[model samples]
Target chain A: MAAGEVSSLEDCLEEHLPPAVLQHVWRMLYGKDTRKLDLPKSALTASLEKDFQLKGFGFEAAIEQLRQPRVVRVGLIQNKILLPTDSPVSEQVAALQKRIADIVEVAAMCGVNIVCLQEAWTMPFAFCTREKLPWTEFAESAEDGQTTRFCQELARKYNLVIVSPILERDEFHGDTLWNTAVVISNSGKVLGKTRKNHIPRVGDFNESTYYMEGNTGHKVFQTQFGRIAVNICFGRHHPLNWLMYSINGAEIIFNPCATVGALSEPMWPIEARNAAIANHCFTCGINRVGTEHFKNEFTSADGQKAHHEFGHFYGSSYVAAPDGSRTPGLSRIEDGLLVAELDLNLCRQINDKWAFKMTGRYELYADELAEAVQPNFDPYIVTE
Target chain B: MAAGEVSSLEDCLEEHLPPAVLQHVWRMLYGKDTRKLDLPKSALTASLEKDFQLKGFGFEAAIEQLRQPRVVRVGLIQNKILLPTDSPVSEQVAALQKRIADIVEVAAMCGVNIVCLQEAWTMPFAFCTREKLPWTEFAESAEDGQTTRFCQELARKYNLVIVSPILERDEFHGDTLWNTAVVISNSGKVLGKTRKNHIPRVGDFNESTYYMEGNTGHKVFQTQFGRIAVNICFGRHHPLNWLMYSINGAEIIFNPCATVGALSEPMWPIEARNAAIANHCFTCGINRVGTEHFKNEFTSADGQKAHHEFGHFYGSSYVAAPDGSRTPGLSRIEDGLLVAELDLNLCRQINDKWAFKMTGRYELYADELAEAVQPNFDPYIVTE
Candidate 1:
């Protein structure tokens, strides 16, 4: 790291917070790259790098004679909402569209095949504000939403598969709102959508006030690049969320989240990396950057006074390979894009070495969990 | 970190090895304590600290007037086999017993309620050598094994619940051998055994050559201090292995492991820590330290030449809390003990905050795994 960066990080250490509350502080002190998988920067990327923090890595695998290497470049983009919460919904959408389009163009120049945006990238993270009027207006149809149309145009122009997580207004049965990810193919066609299964009611994440838990099962979309799945935001905390996606033949799972430093920064580095090792699949953790301030004040119900600003949305986006090696994260305080080139063959290679699936003994766990769910179930507790 | 330690760690980075092969090298560069939960060194522990690297931390929790705090001080012991592999079996057992006895005495003085030793603590990790004669001689009955008998006396004397991982020779059932952890209660009675469910076939872990998969299910023993379970060695890699123990009502799980650096150092820090977070339980990862050379050389079937020593054991024992915070590890090259004082109430506190159990949706996964085990079952794969 540069001397200036070290001095800035040292400033964060002087905040005088308790250790548990500042769990991610000590790691920020190092301010050095943990792994060295440097991706060569091109002229196009270099020009855009000045606008935002753009960094990348490549996951290398051994050569196999019979099987050709499946090299898929995945780009994770984390950005801030440019407008305030009280701004017009269309204006907010337009600002994010333009900002993300520039980053996607840079990713295309850097040869990113699949691109993923941070959770609910179309509007401000206003759920914490607990206001339904201006916030719910941002929700759009998943099939042909304004965000989807924008991503579709970019996907076709750049010849890239784009994953757009947005607030969905489902119009089929009822006008029910949902947290969903729309997968647009390189051909500009809407492939399908996966809803966020788990919902959070903790702290300032009053997400349950807007939408209930999703109905969609763990779904993997097979694109030309790779088999991908999305575990949105709070779902990353649940290991089974990652496992079910892997069981469904997803080689790459993306955790597009909008969590803050106080709530989940310490867990951010660990969950995705651990998922990669346990599931024998590549994992991408993309968190939204910058603090989003709302028009109304919010209280977390934890004895703290009401405040207008939500905690800092730590933007340490990075990728973890199937072998448990991970790339260094983007800046915590800056909008950034992390591009990772992964060899799909590493998934099977790690599986062969670890034999996790073969030795997983799914049958035993099936029986155990089955027995556990019973109304009069007895836990296998051996008490003296 | 001291200047001497930093210089020594820097020296290890100079050894030429590919990035993938030396995954743990970068973390060693920062030899500073990652978390600050320092336990005060008592004079009793200070005397024994001179013999080996002894370090500890304490887990603090919120105060509740309705419920009394259940603080359990747990000690993890990791040590190398003091004698050569070719040494007399009786002499080897005697040496290890005396060394472990001294460590347990220190733990008693430090007010540890439970103590756990590394896997196959009384024997050299001989399974890697794929030899049978001298190693098989080390196996004894779990109920009355020489190692268990020794631990029984220590438990009675110190009033400590001891978990001893040993090679169990089930003489009553065709003299079958199994990797088992015999849990001795605080009163010194044998409290049954939990075997290593997942046997590894990767690298030099030729465990299947000695015994088949364990028959004993994931068992959590409700001792006086805490409800504890043992997920021995290779079982750490499987998330379900940890889940079953938690579902069985374990507040703390001890992973008594015997792993080498090259094969698992990168994964060692992650698996146990992830388990603690996912299961809402305190986890102790205890690994044997130092390299044990065998009399005969063995080949790992990976085109490598025959070798006398299984790679460095890489002790690095640590304790992880349910809140995702972990203590700095013990030395990578020294026999050490990690004592952690944990309030069992923190497990429930984390569970309430995360609501992992309520939101886990176990019934869905149970059915998914049940379908997965069928011969004609189709995996939930989506293809273009």
Candidate 2:
């Protein structure tokens, strides 16, 4: 339960269980994470050793289609801050950019039409420190931030849609701060940006100390590849967040998150997959991989002692399809790029089979939610 | 994929895989289904060889509590039709009642405070046959029906609460037929009823043809043991159905289902478990076992050939706690009783830890849903 650890008991059990048994269990439990996509090795991929792990898989659907399958290749990147928390912010940003550029190049080689980075990928996840001077320096304008510029160049060069999540400094609204995702189209133009609607107050997140909830509504971006929406980090916990994106005609929803293992590992697999099933859309769940340490000690209200580091950010990023099938996830201990090819037509096909939209009865729920939110609302409990 | 079969490929794989590997895969994929609850062997349990499978597990939680833990023992029964689908309606009902009596007796002996049976437990699942004669004959009045009266006597004798999901014949309302769960209190009184809100239209489930949407809102019944709600059958597919029960102060939600494997096997685990996580409540997912053969052929919208029976109803009943842990599921091919002891205190404790209620922003979602339900509503999509 300590910081920088991913379940002491699980570690102990992993050591005791046979390797074949562990593999069998995970394969049975998670299904085939993904059938290994045998991509011909490129110069960039072959040159890099274990430093940058690149994985690819495909989610095939069996729905009847009149038109040709609209297969869109998507990439998700989970990486650690290359520099220490005490390192210079500029140096940290530069190191992350260089590492990400290498991975994105590999994704492009593997024909990824769209790609996304982890939440706040440009800098260390240093909100746990609650320090204003140093961490606040990482925030920049989403319109033309250094990170946005870098992603734009890659997106245009590779002809890929890029979703870049960042710490935003909104100067127009009296210099407000927000957690935002900057969507860049394949043509290198800045498509509209969407902010994280939900903020976390639990654990050592201390995100509420930095910024309030986002003002932007749920916005799905229309790109040449597909209609995509980003549900950043903590918003994955709310089913309504996912539902709104689906209601807005989003074909694929990306959840770029920064969460540790002890707090959320058990829930990591279930939530996004459930969202994909409920919404009849594709969902990509991406997480930061390594433990993030702060120069200052922090304490969570869970009675744990004050610690200088958040627990390990277990990276098990994967893609879930509309048909209730998912690709295997990336490694929990490594920085990896998970590339998945999806047929966009599967979205409508799943809806055709399940009829979630037709059977949902959205009007009744709208009334129920409206009534429940009333000040004098009484829960419909049958006391009799 | 044939009627009365679970999965052809899964069966083939099971034949090939070593038993140890299969066990490892199941244990790994499902985690520990449940640590075996060593109950003192009873006469009824001892007498039944493999006819009745009795299983139990305990879900323990760790949280700061001021009051003593409120431990409630719950029992879920997944059963098979005791008679052939074409049998006399009265004989079919009598045969099922005799079988249920034995199961309820075992549950009472296991100290079950509240028990729930699978959907339409007293009759064969003949809805797929789309025949109105024998199936309609099985429908009875909720108040003085033969099934409700039988449950009332058992409830009073054992001082237990029972949830009987039955095909209800509403005598006053034009002899309307509906899928209802009659809540029988410990004193053998009818504690009102809640109907299945969502009806399935896919696969071989011809539910919408038989009944319309339930008039009863998501009703949480306050019993002596705990506040409970029944989201019968297809309601599990809708996240809002589960949320309304939680919003109405339900501590435990029972999903009594009669679905086939080909249609919903992949979804069986994810939906209810995700509900328990999203709602911060305990969810018991119960499914009917075995396949019922009909004299007439049935054809679904799917391209499969006409069949005499619906596909297998793979029974994998299990309990999911507020925390992300779940007990192992029951058998897929057997009639079984899964009893789990839960501390109701875990409900609020999870809410305290996750604060899902506080951060959920229900008002925002209420407005979003309201706008979405409007006839001329425009989705909040970003095209620029």
Docking quality band of candidate 1, CAPRI definitions? acceptable
Q: After superposition, how far is residue A72 of candidate 2 from its true place, in Å?
A: 0.3
Query: Model 2, which residues run further than 4 Å from truth?
Result: A1-36, A47-50, A63-65, B1-36, B47-50, B63-65
lDDT of 1 by residue, B321-375 (tens): 8877777678777778788888999999989888788878888888888887889
| Candidate 1, lDDT over the whole model | 0.82
- How close is each model in CA RMSD to the real structure? 5.7, 3.8
Each prediction's number of clashing residue pairs? 0, 8
Model-by-model DockQ, in order = 0.38, 0.46
Tens-place lDDT per residue, model 1, A127-217, is 9988898889989998998888989999999999999999999989589999999999999999888999899887889898999887778
Query: What's the TM for model 1?
Result: 0.91
Model 2 local distance difference test score: 0.84
Give lDDT per model, in order. Answer: 0.82, 0.84
For candidate 2, list the clashing residue pairs, or say none: A4-A311, A29-B29, A33-A327, A33-A328, A34-A328, B33-B327, B33-B328, B34-B328
